[model samples]
Target: MRKPNAARDQLLHDLRNAYEGGASIRTLVASTGRSYGSIHSMLIESGTPLRGRGGPNHRRRVP
Candidate 1:
């Protein structure tokens, strides 16, 4: 088993790479085995700009 710090660091690295590569939060959560809130917070703490609601193909609702 990996140490706590090492595991965290690996998670961060994976998260950064996945996010930068355009992976969605859902995707990250699935792949990382992390909670949505946790992933969201990590991204925020890492200075990663959060993507707007919906995904790449998501269209804004017509008013």
Candidate 2:
């Protein structure tokens, strides 16, 4: 459980870390009980480069 009223920086750090670690915003929303818009906004606010749709390896590369 997180402390109520956690600092913005701290929350952003956690959100960014989770996102970078391959956890999607939807996953975070489920875990954090926050809305999709809230999660998306925070990721943007934290300057975390958002991933494209369909997640990892959506398309295969020719070798």
* lDDT to native, each model: 0.82, 0.92
Weakest 10 consecutive residues of candidate 1 by summed lDDT = 2-11
Cα lDDT tens digits, model 1, 1-63, are 745687777777778778989999888999878899999988876678777776378667888
Question: Model 1 Cα displacement at 14 (Å)?
Answer: 2.1
TM of each candidate vs. truth: 0.66, 0.76
lDDT of 2 at 24: 92
| Candidate 2 ranges with C-alpha deviation above 4 Å | 1-6, 55-63
Residues 16-47, candidate 2: write the lDDT tens digits: 99999999999999999999999999999889
TM-score of 2: 0.76
Give all candidate RMSDs, comma-separated. Answer: 5.0, 5.8
- Model 1 residue runs over 4 Å out of place are 1-6, 55-63
